[model samples]
Target: MADINEPVDVLIIGGGASGAAVAWSLAETKMRIVCLEQGDWIKNEDFPSTGRDWEARQFGDFAISPNRRKLAADYPINEDDSPIKVANFNGVGGGTILYAGHFPRFHPSDFRVKTLDGVADDWPIDYATLEPFFELNDKMTGVAALEGDPAYPPKPAVMPPLPLGRSGEVIGEAMNKLGWHWWPSDAAINTQEYEGRAPCINLGHCGSGCAQGAKATTDGTYWPEAIRARVEVRHRCRVRRIETNEDDMATGAFYVDPDGVERFQPAEIVIVACNGIGTPRLLLNSASERFPDGLCNSSGMLGKNLMFHPYSQVRGHVDEKLEGYMGPRIGTWSMQFYETDPERDFKRGYCYQFSRGYGPVATAVNGMADGIIPWGAGHHDAFGRMFDHSLGMLAICEDLPEEINRVTIDPDLCDSDGIPAPKITYRLSENSKRMLEHSVARGKEILQAAGARDITSKTIFPAAGWHLMGTARMGTDPKTSVVNEWGRSHDVRNLFIVDGSVFVTSGGVNPTSTIQAIALYVADQIKNRIYELFD
Candidate 1:
């Protein structure tokens, strides 16, 4: 037991979305479980927004991109070949640390993309199989939502909805006039203090890390419960490879500790919860004589079919002051165009989210980028023209899984731990482009209907890579996918994956809720079939 290669019943890698959820789900069991995270625990005081210079810090140190953050725990991602930038955090909470807590579930149509739309491949499991897990996770994480949305099957009780500020009212009214479906957002943010956490104070900078603990990050929610249940969490341990036995069965993981010493943790079952890119990176790097291609790449689909939501935003400047700087950044949303229509050239549809404009400093900086604010005396007036009066709508466009879009290891680039960085090679498909174009046009119309004069729209939103999906997709056939419906590796039964990488289709919504649901569902399957998992 004193050996570094101490054996355990289960070992989970990456303490992010699915990692934390799986740990929490399996905590009540008698099995010994341990999770390894590359980043350290985030301190409440480390949130920049709590300080006076937070706005400046937001652009500098607190930027969402891993390359920009450049923290000790961060692993560099080569995004030169990708149109959409990869933005994620390397901490116990993972990307949830900077996410806006937008927790939208994948639509039912999302699972049947290949059958219904003849575009992307369909998921092995349907929404019905995962619906119970979705509700269970919502109860655990405390979602802020409203009832009576025609889009969903009766949603279980969520916390009282977050306040829809003037911006949401404007967008809601516009959607009503246009005969579109709009609903208060399904967010992980607390409104009436659920569990032990406090309610959101309307701080307006949720993307910069919520200092008030109102936003439900994994570190703030699942990790605490998991730790209490005796799940050992080791921080600052970077996993280098997944080791396999002579029969090509997964034994455990080899990782590098913070003290620059190599360590091994043997386990009966090894689960990979590293997001789309990181999962592929670890697998591709763990090559052996038995599986020279990769541990689970016998199908040659390990790092293929990378999908990201192609997103864009339309910002409108209203005549009346809307105080756009206040309230949650993303609250109300419209899903009228969620289902694909034959009239539209796109295969799948997109969702529209009403967003509050940035702070005064961010607004001024944005104006400078667009040349709205010049160098001289014109700066102040141009900045004030859109300071507190601007409200925007973001269109989350569905991206199909294309074989060409993938995650590969960068041979030349290595991280701080001497591990090869993951290289993303992604581009929006023609279908995606058409979907984004149509969504932007509709967004401009909604902004105009809301009594806005100056409106600006773009094809690509700068910071929109928060939701990563695909790469190691789930399917029925071992030849076509990396994992089965239960998230078990088709080649190596002892290995499992419970992250966005198992997503077959890129749903036109935020993936945090769906990611957690998948994890919970997979964990339940493991619990039921513990003895037969590797059979």
Candidate 2:
């Protein structure tokens, strides 16, 4: 028996990026909204950047992989079967806590992949429908970028772009020499003071959590406003499953509190803002007598079509003593191969996200791993040369949805709360392999053109499973999708999803900005149809 709580108008799960956006968007309605988060809020001082061992903490407490962190809030993910392991954060701001803050909007053509490229399914909603929401989200998050980039349509910037440091200058000149398109990356990091947050002070490791409050994580951006609007966010409450009524409607959810007690939260509507992998895990765990195959999984698409941006990296050292390890990881990007081409070996192309070099510890560790630095006396000399002179680019390859790659509940694995853990079974597609080859070749060319020597490449960066998407995809047809265009579950009328799980196609760019936009759009739709929301 579980303790019953007061019913609310709406219940939101996972108070990360999408969850924060949805809560803030729906705050105007004055509904009794409550959000459940597994992890507690992280203090700014507790962030690794404030400490001396900041670089080492990235491989330990703040490591992106939940399995390595194994915190109380984190559930174990069985990624032994997959090559690219999952990288996520279970805290209030989710992955944004450790993200590079590289925000990029999906190209308009990204929405019509199937229509134009004759591969993958097109999104139920287009970039046009979500444009206003994107703009609104950018304003709220204080996105910094330069306008009039040839890669995307005219988009507004709330602040000036982050300065393109030495690495960006080198990459920019290299791309220009090759006649490729390069642009300052749209970043959620503050370049100037905005909304009470200070500007970035050239902090080297933005991924280990920004102590300066410069990066736009949801906890700093939307959560404050939402909290002021009376949206209740309950921390350390790990939801075990969503509870459903006999009518096949979502009533609320069953969760474990901080004191380790099972409780039931009743609500008029339920919205799942868990990311792609987490969303499917929750849905599949919420099985009932009437819905034995898992809630709203009649189409058998609940945990299928798992997609990750298969990533590859090409790095090299230049002769110049460049300050390449002292700013945001991604300063600029090349969209030269973002769209599809008839002459390409693969269908969809990839974006070249040029990044600064790593910190001292990271450089030494990576250099040793790649056999670039020896273990003895020569190690010091090798480390010193590669410390500040290295530059790299990640190939953010577009991973098309495939039914074979999926998230399944592990038969033997469970989390701290005894919830079944998610098992990832994924493989790099043939198209992705070919795309990586092309990306590596192009990346090497750019590095060589920049007078870089000792160039190295990783065809498949195994730990680069940062972008998780496409399991519970959105579409018009119920037979082919889990949710409708507006993010409502096909079977459960009062249930909605506003996370990357609703993504129909994984674009070549990072999904956080787009994920928040979709969440805001879904919130807008829920507000508009409040009267007939259950219909």
Candidate 3:
């Protein structure tokens, strides 16, 4: 037996990035909207930066991996079968709470991968269709960047770019010497006072929740506005499954409240904004007589085509003290190899996102782990040499859609609520391997140009699974994708998805900006065709 709640006009699951955007966008409709979040609001005072052991907390309570964090709101993901582990935050702001705020939009060529590279499937909608939404999202998020980047098409910055510190200046000069395209990163962290949030004061680690409210997490941006517009967000409610009627249309969802009691929330329309793995897990768990496979899985593509942006890191140590840890984690990026070239070994290409070095504790811990810093007497001297003298770049490689690399329900692993957990079955493609190699070689060249010493490289960074996408892809054909071009389900018309799960192809850059843009675009379509939305 379950307590049935009053039916609302719209019910949104997951109050993260895309969910927050959708709720805010649809608020103008004046329809009853309720958003269910698994986690509660995290106060700014509780952020890691406010504590003495901030760096230590990054590996513990605020760890990106939910398994390690072991928070009550988090559901364990069985990623033992894959090389790359899952990194996410289960909260009102979701992964954005732990992100470095390096926001980048997908290139125009990203939407036409098959046409340009003859590798992955092309997205049903092009970049132009979502350009306005991208601009809107940028304004709302207060993206900070420089103008006149040769890589992108005339996208203005919401604020002046974050100051290019010593590391950024060095890297930019190196790229200039190499004649590679480099630009200021479109960061979500506030560079100046905007939207009532204070500017970033170089608080060092932006990944562990910005205590100064500088970072543009959705909980701080959209959620407040949506709440003011009468959107009700219920925290600490974990959805077990979506419930559908006999006609195979989503009626509501069955969720466990904070009290551990089952409750049914009915809605005229249901929108799933859970991330890639979570969306698939919920859909698979919502199996009914009509949907023997899963809800909206008539195409059998609900849990297929999982893509994780393979990440690589290359670091170099300079003689001059760069003070790398004194600024935002990321500063500039290079799109020199973003587009595929006939001469390259890989079909698609990647982006070089330059990042500053770690804090004091991180540098010490990593140095010991890498055998750079020995125990006892030699420790202080070695740590002194590396503390603020290092700079690095992450090679964010594009991951093609592969049906074999999927998210499946783990038979043995279950969450605290007894709901089955998601298991990742993924492997790096040969193209990804070659792409990583090319990027690493180029990265080393740039570091050498900058007169760096002791350059080290790490390929396939095991814990770099921050970007989860493509499990429930959107496309024109029902046989290939779970959702239609408008993000509506092919099997269930009234059900929609607005998350990384709806991505058709995983681009080389971070997907947060593009994900929010797509959500806003879907919300616009729904608003325009409100009467025919269910048709």
196-273: candidate 1 lDDT, tens digit per residue: 999998888888888888999999899999999999999999999999998778989989888978898999999999
Q: How many residue pairs clash in all the candidates, one count each?
A: 0, 0, 0
Could you report the Cα RMSD, in angstroms, for every candidate shown? 1.5, 0.7, 0.8
lDDT of 1 at 17: 83
Task: Output candidate 1 Cα RMSD.
Answer: 1.5
What's the TM-score of every candidate structure? 0.98, 0.99, 0.99
Per-model lDDT: 0.89, 0.93, 0.93
- Identify the runs in model 3 with alpha carbons over 4 angstroms from their true place: none
Residue 335 CA displacement from its true place in model 2, Å: 0.5
Which rank order by lDDT, best down to worst? 3, 2, 1
- Candidate 2 backbone collisions, by pair: none
Candidate 2 worst ten-residue window by lDDT: 321-330
| Ranking 1 against 2 by lDDT, winner | 2
Candidate 2 lDDT over residue span 345-365, tens digit each: 999888988899988889999
